[model samples]
Target: MITVPDESGIVPFLRAGPPPDRTRHEGWKRWQDQRDKFIPAPRLSLEEYAALSPRRRALHDLHRTATHVNLGLLETPMSAKVTKLMRGRLRNNALNFEPGTRDGLMVSGGGYLGKTETACDAAATFEALWRDLHRQLLPGPIPGTRDLFVPVAYCRTPVRATPKGLCAAILDFYAAPHPKTLHGMVRQVADSIRVHHTTALLLDDVTRLRLHREDDQDTLDLIRELMDLNVTLVLIGVDIPNSGLLRGGRPDPRTGQWILPPVKPGQTFNPGAATQTERRFDLVDLDPFDYDSPKGIKAWLDHLAGIEDRLRLLQARPGMLTEGAMPEYLFRRTGGIVGLLRRLIEDGCTEAIDSQAEELTVDLLAGIPIRLGNLADRDPTAGEIPEIPEDIAVPAPAPRPRRKGRNTVFDDRGERPAADA
Candidate 1:
C-alpha cells in the first residue's frame, strides 16, 4: 500500500506551500506579493554545498528551483536609456499637483524585450517613492472616502476589449465592484482613480485593441478621458507605432516623432474640462541586443558576465559564458533577445543540475532549443552554434589594400603560416 504524505505536519517536508496564482498577476495584490516576496536563492560554493547532508542539499535544491538560474530583470543599453525617458515623463506628470491633465508615456517594442517589465519597474519605483514621501498614507486624503491609496495601477488590455471591458479591467485591478454598463464602469474607474490617489496607470498590451473595430475607438477615447482623472497613463505594447494607434497622426516636422492627435471634439463628454488639445505623450523603443557593434557586443558580454555571476551552479567558473566562443555562441543561440536568452539559460541550468554536469557549456546549451517569445512577431534562434567563432573580432583597417589576398592559418603540425596544397 502507498503511504500518503501528511497534510498537517510540523516537519517542512510534510507540509505544503500554496500554488502561485498566476491569473491575478495584473492585480495589485499579486504584483505587490511578487515584488516583495521574490528572493533569489542564496549561492553556496561547490565545496560548501557538497559538504551539506543529503536532506539539507535537497532542501537547498528545492529553494533553488525558484531562482537558481533566474537573472531577474537586466539593464541593457536600450532599456536603461528608454527607462530614463519614461521615468522622467512619469515624474514630470506625477509631481504636478496643480495638474489639469498630465502627459503620458508610450513604450513600444517587439515581444519579450522586457518592455512591460521595464515600464512596470519604473512605475513601481515611482510609487514606492511617492508613498514614502506621503508617509505611506493616503495622499491628500478625502474625508468619508475608504478607497485604498493606490499610487500605481497595472492591468492588461483584454483581447476583445471594449470601453466597458477596459473600464472593468481597471476596476478589477483594485478589486472594486462595478456595474455592467460602460458609463457606470467608466465613472467608477475615474472616481476610484482620483480617490485612491493613483498617479500612474499602466495598461500593457494596448496593441491588442483593433483600431478598425468601432468598440476599440470608444475604448481609446475612454483612455484619453482617464488621463483627465489626474493620472499619467503608462501605455505598453508590441509595435505600437505600427499598430495604427496614431490614426491620422503625423510625425513632428522638426523632431520626426509621431505626434498622436488629442481626443476629437465629438468624442468629448465633459465639456467643462480644460482646453484639451494635444495629449502630451512620448514613445520609446526597446530593441534586442545587437551583436554586430563593438558597444553592443561589450554590453552583451557584460550581460553574460552578470548572468554568470548570479548562477548557482557548482561547476560554474569565471568567464564560463563570456570567454572564448561562448559569447557569440550564446548570441547566435538566442539571437540576443533577452527573454529567449533567459529561457535558454534557465532551462540549461535545470538540465545541468539534473544531468549532474553542474555547469553550462556550449555543447550542453546547444541542444536546448530557444522556444520562447511570440512566434507571430519575433523569431527566436533555435540554440544551435553554426560556427564556434563567427568573426566576433573587429576587423582593423589593413595598412594597404591588396587586390588578392588569402588568410594563411597554421596547419595541425603547429608550423608557420602555410598556403593551400
Candidate 2:
C-alpha cells in the first residue's frame, strides 16, 4: 500500500495531485469550436460564453471538454416518462449493488442547459457518499471529501476523447506534478480512492465524442474500463433522440428508424425485477428548465439577480476591473439555460463596460438580442407587459393554424380560403 498524505496530513494510501489545472480556457475554446460543426449552429459567442458565473461557465465548458465523445446530441425532455423509467430501474430486485458495478447515472440536457453544474454537484454528492461509506467501513472520519466540489472549468489539460487518449488523459489528470507520468500516479490514486470506495467518476460534456463516427467504440471501451475499477461514471451532455448517444443506422420496423439500444439494466432497457444485472449504472434524462413555467421563470430571475449581485459586489471591491452581469441578463432573456444565458450576458456586459456604464441593467442587456428575443417577439402583446407577476396565471392562447397566401384559413383543397365580404 502506498503511503500518501492528504492536505490535512492524514496518510492512509491515496495521493491526488493538485486538482486538475483550472487555468485552461483556451483548450476549452478549441473543443467548443470543433463540436459546433457537428451540432446545430450554436447561438453563443466566446465573449458571451465567458461572462457566466463560474458555475454556469463550467457547464458550457463541458461541451468544449467532451468534444470527442458524444457530439450531434439533441435536447430531450426530462418528462414523467423518463422519471418513471428511472424509478422502475432503481427498484428492480436483480440489481447487484456491488461496489464495482452498480448502474451509474448520466446527466444530460440542451446545449445551454446546466448539465455541467449538475455533474459537478453529482460528483460532490458521490464523494460525500464515498466518505459516508468509508466511515461505515473504517473507525475514523475521512477529510478532503468534505469539499469534493472542485471547479474544473479552467483545468488546462486537453481532454483526450479517444480510448487510448482518454486513458492518457486520466493519467495526466494525476501526473502534472509528479516525476512519473500522470497515468502511473493515477493508478495509485485510483487504488486509494477505490479502496476507500470513492471511485465515482464525473465526466461533463460527453457529447464531444460524436464527431467521430467510429469513436463510439472508444466510449464503450472507456466506460467498460471505468466499470472495471468500480467507478460509477456520470456523463453530462445534450440529449439525443434515443437512449443511445450515437445515432444513424438501418431502420427497425417497430420504430421505423433503427432503434438504438435503450439504457437498460447492465445496458439492457427495462430490466425485469428478477434479472441479475438490474442494479447497474442508470441513465437519466434531464430536461431544459421550462422557462415558460411559473417555477422555472422564478428560478431564472433569481439566477439573474444573484449574478447581478455578484458583479456589483466585485466592482465595488478592488482587484476586480470588470464586473460580470452578462449571465444575469442572460437568465432574464434566455430563461436560464446557464450556457447560452452566460454567453449573451457576457457579450452584452462587455459591450456595456466598453461604453462605460456605472452599473449593469436591462438597457445593457439589449445588446445580446439572441434567439430568446425572437421568441419574446411572439409573446402576446396585449396588456402592458409588467414585471411577470408572481403566481400569475396567463391563459395560453387558443391554437390557430397559420393561413397561406391570403392571410386566412386554407380551403379543403389546400388552397387559401377566399375572403368574406
Candidate 3:
C-alpha cells in the first residue's frame, strides 16, 4: 500500500483541523499560509483567483513547482490542439457528467516538443474548471459535500511499460487505509468521482505501452478497466508509428512501443471530432508550432513575451518588441515553432543574466540556441540559395574594374574575382 502523494490533502487541512499531531499540523498550517499568500497575488486576475478553490489552488501550486519547465509558446498547433481538447471537455461538462468515459488519452509528438507541459496544463485547467463548476453546482453551504475539486486518485509517470507493475502502481495510489486491489482501486476511483463527483487517473507517460516483447494483453486489460470504471487516462510522449511502436518500432524494452489503442466501431483518434467511441481514447498530436504563417509567428512571439514578463528572471529585456510587436528576428529565429522560439529566448536570457546585461538584442540572439537550421533542412520549402548576404562581410565582390587590356588576367589562384584584373 504505497501512499501516493497527498495533493488534495492541503485543502482539507485548510478547511478543517487535522488530527492532533502538533508538528504535522504546524507544518500544514505554514504550508496553507504560504499557499494563500501567493495565490491572491496582484498578478492574478480576480476572476482567475475566484475560479480556483483552495484544493485546486494547492494542486496548481504543487504541479507548478514540480512541472514548471518553461512551456515556451502556447500558440503552436500542438498547443492549440491541447487547448481545444480541454475546452471540449469543459464545454461538454465532461467532469460533471460522471460514469464518464475513463478511456484516457495519448499525446504524441517529436522530441523537445512540449508534451509534459501539455499534460500539466491540461491537468491544471481540468482541475480549475472542475472546481469552478462544482462551486456553481452547490450554491449554498452544502453539508456532507466536499468543497475540493476532483482529486488525483493516482498519477504515475512511465507506467512501468509492464502491465502488472502499472496495475500495482495504480492500486498503490489508493494507499493502506483504502483498498489495494485493482477492482478495489477502480471502486475507489468511482467513489471519489461521485464524492467530489470529479476525479481523474492521470498516467502521464503511457508511451511505454507498446513494448514489443511485452505482451500488451495485460496493458489492454488495465485500459479496459479504466474505461469501464470511467477514469480519464492521459498518455504523453513522442509520436508512435503506424504499428503503434513509439520508440521507432524498437524491440528493445528500453525503447518502448506505441500501438494503436483498441477502439469501438465508428471511433477514431481525431482531435477535431465532436464525439468518440465508448472507450474514447482521444489522440492529440502536438505538431511543432508553425512559425511560418504570419498569424502564427505573431502569436508565438507574443506568447514568449508574455512568459518572459511573468518570469522576471530574464536579466536582459527583449528590445523594443512590445507585447504585440512581431519582429522578423523572432519570426525567422523560431522557424515558426513557438517551443524553439521560447528555448532561444530563455537561453539568451540566461546568458544575459550571467553577463549582467540590460537587453537581449539581435546580436545576442544570433548565437542563441536554434534548431531552425535543422528544421530548414527537414523543410520541404528550402530551395537552392539564390543570393548570399552582404552582411556576412566576405564580400561577393561586384564586377571588378577591368584592366585597360581586354585580355583576361588570372590571379595567382588561377580563378578570377574579375574577368580581367
**Top TM-score: which candidate number?**
1
Candidate 1 residue lDDT tens string, 113-194: 7887788777777776777788755355578964467778888787777888888878877778888776677778888787
Model 3 TM-score on a 0 to 1 scale: 0.52
lDDT: worst 10-residue window of model 2: 377-386
Evaluated against the true structure, the overall lDDT of model 1 is 0.72
Q: Model 3: clashing residue pairs?
A: 102-231, 104-233, 105-233, 210-257, 244-258, 244-259, 245-258, 246-258, 291-336
TM-score of 2: 0.45
Ranking by lDDT: 1, 3, 2
Higher-TM-score candidate among 1 and 2?
Answer: 1
> Per-residue alpha-carbon lDDT of model 2 for 1-421, expressed as tens digits?
2211123433322223532231232333233334334331133444654566665444333332222122232223333334444333323311345543445555555654555544443333333444555568656645754322221221111233554455445434433233254345445434533443434455554555543445545454344445444445555555633434544323445533222233334542112223322223445556544566677655555555444433321122322222244333344455445445555545554554445452444555564454333334211221111122123222343477777667445446565557732
After the best TM-score superposition of candidate 2, give how far the Cα of residue 361 lies from its true spot, in angstroms.
3.4
RMSD of each: 9.7, 19.4, 16.3
Candidate 2 residue 137 C-alpha distance from true site, Å? 6.9
- List runs of model 2 lying over 4 Å from the truth: 1-100, 125-160, 176-197, 240-243, 246-279, 313-335, 346-356, 368-421
| Counted clashes in each candidate structure | 0, 29, 9
Off by over 4 Å in 3: 1-78, 90-104, 132-154, 171-198, 215-217, 240-278, 307-343, 365-421
Whole-model lDDT values for every prediction: 0.72, 0.41, 0.47
Pick by TM-score: 1 or 3, better one: 1
RMSD of 2: 19.4
